[model samples]
Target: MAWYDEAIFYHIYPLGLLGAPKENSYDGVTHRLKELDPWINHIKEIGCNALYIGPLFESVGHGYETTDYRKLDSRLGDNKDLKRFVKKCHDKGIRVILDGVFNHTGRDFFAFKDIKENREKSRYKDWYCNVNFGGNNEYNDGFSYDNWGGFNLLVKLNQRNPEVKDYICDTIRFWVSEFDIDGLRLDAADVLDFDFMKALRAVANEVKPEFWLMGEVIHGDYTRWVNEGTLHSVTNYVMHKALYSGHNDHNYFEIAHTQRWLDGMGGSSGQGFKLYNFVDNHDVERIFTKLSNKAHFTPVHILLYTLPGIPSIYYGSEFAIEGRKEKFSDASLRPALNIKDYKDSVKNNPATKLVAALGKVRSETPELSYGDYKELHLQNRQYAFSRNYDGRSVVVTVNNDDNDCMLTLPAGNSVEYVGALFGERITVNNGCIQVCVKANSGEIWVPAEKENKKKKLVELQTITEAGKISDASENKGASGTKEKSDTHSDINGIEADSHTEREEFEPSYEETSESNPAIEAKMNSMAESKKNSKIDSQLNSEAESRSDSKGNYEEGVIAGLQEAILAIMEKNGYVTDQMRNDVYNNTHHDSLVNWVKSFIR
Candidate 1:
């Protein structure tokens, strides 16, 4: 399976994340990135396996205007520090994707500088798109040159030139080989040369077949950019616009129709195209600001995670870090966040919990990642859709109206349906499940029976593979089904009775006095975690036992209360170690959740 097919992306604008100087300080401040090591666990806690770190190379400002590709930005760190950082992330099962600003470069780029000094005599005169020594330019650069989107600071590259193409391709190879990075997110991909992109894809795939190539396509047919040889995926701008507009307008059909077109549900132009789905990113206003009603924010995020395509969470967005891109500057949107302060605030932020839950659910559930799209119901302010792979299915329903709404699902046994969002058993009557969603809320319902069936099939496959089951046994299993196992399951799940197990397995390592220091350290951490969990459980037992005997002990009551808080946090999002520390050190997670719930109520 493709690493990114089911991956959750966490986009971090490094300059903002690191709080680096806006301009180049040329200081070897590699220690600043030590602050980010704590966030690696936070990323994994939220179920994201991929980190789409914004520009980290030597640059002028914002890390986008590139000055050097071979060297690391002194403001951020040296190459050694970056390699160590990436290794740490890889150890935690996180794949890193760097920002590829291939289309343009800052005017101070080495080649551009060379041209300025040598004029028409420069050997690299043909490197840029429209360089000319005609007259003094606006910035008094002694020449006029092609700039990207009328931005004089960002000079465009002549991608058609073989020398320029080779340089970009070689740089990509260097990063992949040197840093062992997984992929690249092409900057300004919409206007990038199609031929160059195809060549780049070839190079990336040749180096590493699993290397993912995603583009920042804002408009037009996304299929044109994400075909076999060009890009694996593009940003889903169409849905990003439709989601907010549809919710604000109270028109579910708008998004429903667009979704159908993208998923090929109703014979639309673009079919089966999975684009990067996001409500906000580095370039736009925060989703919290774009949303008309604050109540709709979670529902919109729900859709982003459940719908086709990979879901990306902009850094600091999960906590409702509000900002908007104003006319002259994006300073508001790209605010520098102190890691400590952000972690402290996250413990009290309810959105963080919700986003974490969605991330975990989206990652573990196969149907959500690679399932067939089917719209079961739609209305003015309400919508329902199902993602089915093999027999396993999950039905997602959203109610954006002011009043609660009842949605009737497809005919199924009552015992089959389980609420993914709330962890409640669904009520199915007469072959149909009646799901009542709260006003301005969304619920994801997964069929428990189907999941169990898939697991059984996997077990059978394992037995078969091990030579424990014969052809006759396999035939017997197939005959036990209602119909013949003729249909093929897609990349998502197992085929009915034609089961195939695709479980991820890690190599077993024995821990001893001779074990590697890193392995020993990890084992020690795991042991400590187990000890803490045991202590928590014992405390809970004491609380319940004391409650039955006398009323309750003070310590037991506090422990019980902490457990409750942790449960609530896990239900909403995976509670991290930092959250737990915050709970024991400062405020309670339950208090923040209760406060948010009280407002919604």
Candidate 2:
């Protein structure tokens, strides 16, 4: 099991976190971070273990392209305040990770500026791409400090340059030595060459080993970059692909898909874990708006916090922020920290109770996150997987459809259900556990007392006595009590329940998820027979659009069930206005998509 399992990461955009008076950029917040412990405490109280702060260095556009890598950006606070913040986080047992931007630096950065001013004669002349700066283009006009895509501020660094390498390496060493940060998320890692990165990493790791160095490798097979000598891991952008997987996708399930992609990475063949996973980050539309169906974000949240890899909740994602284009523009998604209790009645808002529950399960129990993973079940509408760690285990089931789901668990003894997203203990009825789940809700469990060997037999006996069993197999042909039979030796001395003539029970995912062919047939029959005007109008509009041979307009609405889930899979982030405009035709669906996107981006 990966160490990050069950871990809830709270990404904080430093410029906009907490309760501060209205102020201009470069000005300080009226309140200090010390005053905001109540908010940070609230997050800790809710179950977050690490804090991912946005760039805090001097910059032009935002914090990304830094002008000075060493000094703290005054707009945020000073170096002293940063030290205090890291100390506070450590005191609370939370880890801190700084944003490392070695790929490029702002044009005003001292190293590159000095190089430009002195040409080849400059001591720092090798710090940047060596060329005269005269024109707008790189290939056509040969400008030295060419804008990335013709922009003026972000100048690409000369990683081959030794002076530049030393500066970048020193910056990394400072964070680990000074603040004792646990990790570094390198920004724009793909922009730098291999040799430069390996050398810089050696310097950083010298200060503190086991430093989590996750990189933004974006797309393609970046295996060479993610090896042990380089990055510890790379963020799953393939899962980000799920955000745009034809609209009707489950954002959380998409994260689960990243597991497979990560499985394919590195020198191992289907052997290792991916670096980490994220739905939306600072550079994209809030995940809230990226989904096919904006109405089912709660399930997505539950999935992200529980899935196997290190999952990051991009700064404002918990609240579902909405935005267009990438990072800097995403500032609108960042909201001030809230101390007021977030009641469940608020329509599209994330369930605070749900986050707390998922977090508790992740941190307190090692099995669910840090154990061996076994895929117990997988269907189009339901996902059941187990993580077994330290002889303890947790089984998680996620139902992405708009219906209740039942999974035939790993059978042995009757197990107790700890809880689902509802934040309550679960009880079973009939043949199935009979969990009362709404559509788009999921449940996670560990091997219940009756099933777990870690418990004393007496405790196991107590759980079985609680009427959790509906079978004769659990009984040893006596008081329906648990006992080892004369001829059979089951693991944990669990008696045969199947042979014991308990009343037979059957589960019905067929009745819940519409994916069962019978359910689909029933839906088709209902469509042909029913006379509801509302659904018929939608069908008619869909039919008419398909019939339009000219294709004058783009029919952006997801056409099938997958599209439906994809539309709302992720809550929102990185969605361009073009994609949004293309996804739906009606105002109501659009509003729902936008609102749901706002909650998690």
TM-score versus the correct structure, for each prediction? 0.72, 0.65
TM-score of 2: 0.65
Error of 1 at 465 (Å): 53
How much is the lDDT of residue 504 in candidate 1?
Answer: 11
Reference-based lDDT, each prediction: 0.68, 0.52
* Count of steric clashes across candidates, in order: 1, 42
Error of 2 at 82 (Å): 0.8
lDDT of 2 by residue, 1-601 (tens): 3333344677776644532222225444222445445556756866788777867676653566677887676655567777888888878878778888777777678876676566556676556664554432212222345333222346667888777788778878887777788887787676667888798668756877566777876544658777757876777665554433312543333434445444545321123444466777655455666655554455566556555566676654554444333211233434443434332312224444445656666676665455555666655566666666555556676666776765566621334555534444444344235444446666666545543334221100000001111232222221333321110011001111211111012113223422234543565445333323433454445545544643532343324211332233222223333233433322234333333232121
Model 1 has an lDDT value of 0.68
